[model samples]
Target: MPSVEATGAKLYFEESGYGYPIIFIHEFASDMRGWDAQIGHFSRSYRCIAYNARGYPPSDVPEDPQSYGWELAVDDIAALMRHLDIEQAHLIGLSMGGYAALQFGLRYPERVGAIVAGSVGSGCHPAHRDAWLRETSVPSRIFVEHGMVTMAERMARGPARVQLKYKDRQRWREFILRLRQHSPQGMAKTMAHCQAARPSLHDLSHQLSDMAIPVLLAVGDEDTRCLETNLMLKSELPNAGLWICPNTGHAINLEEPAAFNAQVENFLGAVERGSWLRGFPATATIPSLVRSRGARRDHSLIQIDQETEGADVVRLHLR
Candidate 1:
């Protein structure tokens, strides 16, 4: 039960094994246990560190929503790394955590060795941002009042749970119940932070191409929410590789942890060994929606280049 005080919040974190550091940050409303599938496997080969976001389990929550801005969350992570004397470490973040990690990397590239930005995008696409705000904000009321149970039930029914892998109905029910036990206020605060988040990432995108550290941008192919933006990010990131998990949605890591873990291992290995250096997005292409004010609503159908196996591609049609 390791803990650190940062940004007026006490963060709860866990550390396992001993090797090159790898930190896992959970998405909004999720505690550190959301990364259960990763901690065990990676700990055997590398240092695995997972932590609860501020106001989530094992952490403090402020009554004021403004206390939990993205900037503060980013500072919390930076402080955590510094407190641990970790000058550089590999980062794995999901959903909101992914957004935080992307921001962290952009602001402090030298502090990160590599990054696995999972189930998230670079925020360059307006549609992606709108979709995220709408989807996450839609559940703000239920989350703030009833906690994660309602949210988990809806998530369990999403495309990510296609062909359920649960051993039995009882287990699935229990999992959902556990998620329900998550803090309501914590999630509401997170949702508010997301609503206030800025959509532009030009500065980050510019810094991305210059970063020497390797990066992997992964998301579910069925995730219409972030697909457009993820692909946009892949085109701008300097040394990033993209992976789209098939039969999944926004919760790619949770739905296909095995595939997600394998891709992460490969990305980390390539980064450390410096074996693969081929850069994606040979050139940056601006989406017409942002370029032309009077562009038609339906014009180009942008298809995600799903060169990877078992990965789904989401197409965006803009006029």
Candidate 2:
């Protein structure tokens, strides 16, 4: 069991293969084990490192509520890399981890090769800030009152996560089992401070616009909470490319590992080949995709109308 000291806590991590480092950060409901599929696929060609965030088992969980925060999460990633003697690496993070990775890129641009931000931007839109804060406390209180099993069950049934339950019941069961093992106090503090009190991504427009590192913004079509925020990120970040998985949900890496893995591999390939551009081409335009009756419901093909110059129209079919 390899571990690294990160601020006030120690983080447990696992690594495989050897090449350019690729760090994996799990979501709020998951731990490093959530990245098993990704590690299996990427480790063959690249060094894959996944770590359990603070508050998760195998990682130190500070007792004080004040010890958990968004900034600390961002700094923890840096500390882990520094501890491992890694200069720069590609970062892939989901949900909470994604937010940290984005902040890390902003704070340390010179230390990042590329970034994959998946299913992020929850509670980040300005219009939803108030509601998000209020709703976030509900989960925190639940964890404190009913414990991890009760909280895990409720969280597993979230609207954006129901897709996983239906698509793969076995994996969904495993997810719940693992989630139930998390520290209730750690979760409560994380939800209260990190999720409820952290600043929204909308507040970082200036930094996002000036980002120089290549970034891939991925979210499921059914992840309604992140749709608007991800769109905003695509518009703000000059180096970002957006990909919306059809009929997928928040835990996309688990729901559709093949597609997720393929997309990430392609992006990494482009980066390695120096073919990944800084921004969308001047002539490239995203046209509205209006579905025809009887059209395929499982997948969507985006039609880009490149005839118009500087056209940035974005519309998608939503169920």
Candidate 3:
């Protein structure tokens, strides 16, 4: 409904359900309503929280691009978690949200119980960014510099196909139109931050291994944006599980909510049973999850081994 002040800007957010806490973050140009399906499903057993990040609809729009950087966005999340007294929450983010969540988890490891990062690769890979810059940059810059409809032709491609498959032409049109209304400058700033503050989880690999927190990494099989990145990440994140959804795209959460929710539900169940966390209860030592791995030391980088369980084999390199 209404937004709250986390740091300086107003962030729109909604809370629903009534069990273990789960916070959902939306992608660029989209708001908390993106989680409508997830809230409906997960609210039945888990407390679901979805929020609009700064510079999005129903949220404050800061003029300075610096104000909307990824690190700042990550800080906004951390502040919100503290403001809401959410000690530990399962972090679920898509695309830009994924990058923000990763930064938040690295900064406030104690406050995160588990993490589900979709449609985002291990941050800052040159090839990944290059591809994104080509396919996404023009549209992003057009939308930001000129106007929303500058690339309406391009934006319609994915949403149009989605409408055909589901027979929801009217709804699809509205969704795309709403995304078009987003501040072009704001969206550009968000993208710039994502590219500039890109983080490497490689150094944190061993730290993650020791944390043993349940992590589920997912990407659309056809999503050229983050598929290989996720594959690379699966190898480094020791306790992480990977899923590649078929017939999907970069916007997998919106394009395939059923599969997305199922992956989240399964991981949450494992978390409850302490199977994924290796008997290390979330409340007992979440901060310790990242800390237990101790200092970083030189270690051989692990490579992808083979394909297993629908995901590529990832070798875990512990330092």
Candidate 4:
């Protein structure tokens, strides 16, 4: 009853509050419950929805690997919204879910109000394509062979995730506990069909360039795997702004929920007021400057300046 049918599987979902919708999608290692911090905060002002992907428990896991794919994840979001009678909603996702949010923005611009993508672009660097594929694909075999228990042990000690362990032991334990509960078959299918097979963000330059949706890209300074890719995302997406959290790692939201919530709340406000990017996007202005014929923009649409010690913490708002 709390599940919706997608192409080849059923997705279990949860909804809270009552306002303009906000859908929270999870990362590869996480499930719908992973968004508890976000949903708990945003639900006070917005209709918040979170769901377990097709492979996660309570959601049907089709035996057919054909049942899962990267694009299908976006389709699932659309299907979920349609099933709920929602024409459009804001999308907030972390890692894999972040990629899905961007893809959904590209595919159905009409269906998205805005996008907040955190710690996205892991294997998107051109040079890392082959290696990233190998890295991502290997997890499928590992998951299928040793099971989630062993996989969880290995992943809990990952370089980027160590920050979580040191920063919040209890939280890190919670993450690992949930990870161990995942189905090996579902995880294997997900790693193989969804993550390993997904297209690189660099390859989507044209679509990203043409995308007019407002985007907020968040990453961690210690998340070396994603820094370059997030930079690329900022460059390719016209109305994109980026924030780099100093000393943080892969899981930006989980690592810094307080800061994350505050920043996202401000971004959502800006989006609602139609002031996120204002009239002229920075990318559009560059060409305008090259032409040097058009009148300069008198009003400040968006301002970019480094306030904190970290220059990568990009903060944008109408002045």
Candidate with maximal TM-score = 4
- Per-model TM-score versus the true fold: 0.79, 0.87, 0.77, 0.88
Write down the RMSD of candidate 2 (Cα, Å): 10.4
Please give, for residues 1-319, the per-residue lDDT of candidate 3 as tens digits. Answer: 5567766578878898898899898877467777788899999998888888887767877777667676778888877787678889999998778867766776777788889988776344655555555655555566666776654435556632353235445545766776777776666666665544555554455655555456788887767646666876777665678899886766677777787888888887887787663221112212333345462333322232333345654443342
The number of residue pairs in model 1 that clash at the backbone is 5
Off by over 4 Å in 3: 130-140, 158-171, 195-197, 200-211, 277-319
**For candidate 1, lDDT tens digit of each residue in 102-147?**
8888789888888888877534466455665666666777776665
Residue 276, model 1, lDDT: 49
Tens digits of per-residue lDDT, candidate 2, 107-165, equal 99999999999999999988888899889889898898999999899889999998999
Task: Report the C-alpha displacement of residue 72, candidate 2, in angstroms.
Answer: 0.6
Candidate 4, residues 1-319, lDDT tens digits: the string is: 5989899999999999999999999998899888888889999999999999989998998999999999999999999998999999999999999999999999999989999999998888899889988887788999989999999978988988889899999999998999999999999999899998999999999889999898999999999989999999888888888999999998788889999999899998999997776333242223343335344465434445434443566454344
**Candidate 4 C-alpha error for residue 117, in Å:** 0.7
List where candidate 4 sits over 4 angstroms from the true fold. Answer: 278-319
lDDT of model number 2? 0.89
Q: Residue 233, candidate 3: how far off, in angstroms?
A: 0.8
Clashing pairs in 1: 149-180, 296-319, 298-319, 299-318, 299-319
Winner on TM-score (1 vs 3): 1
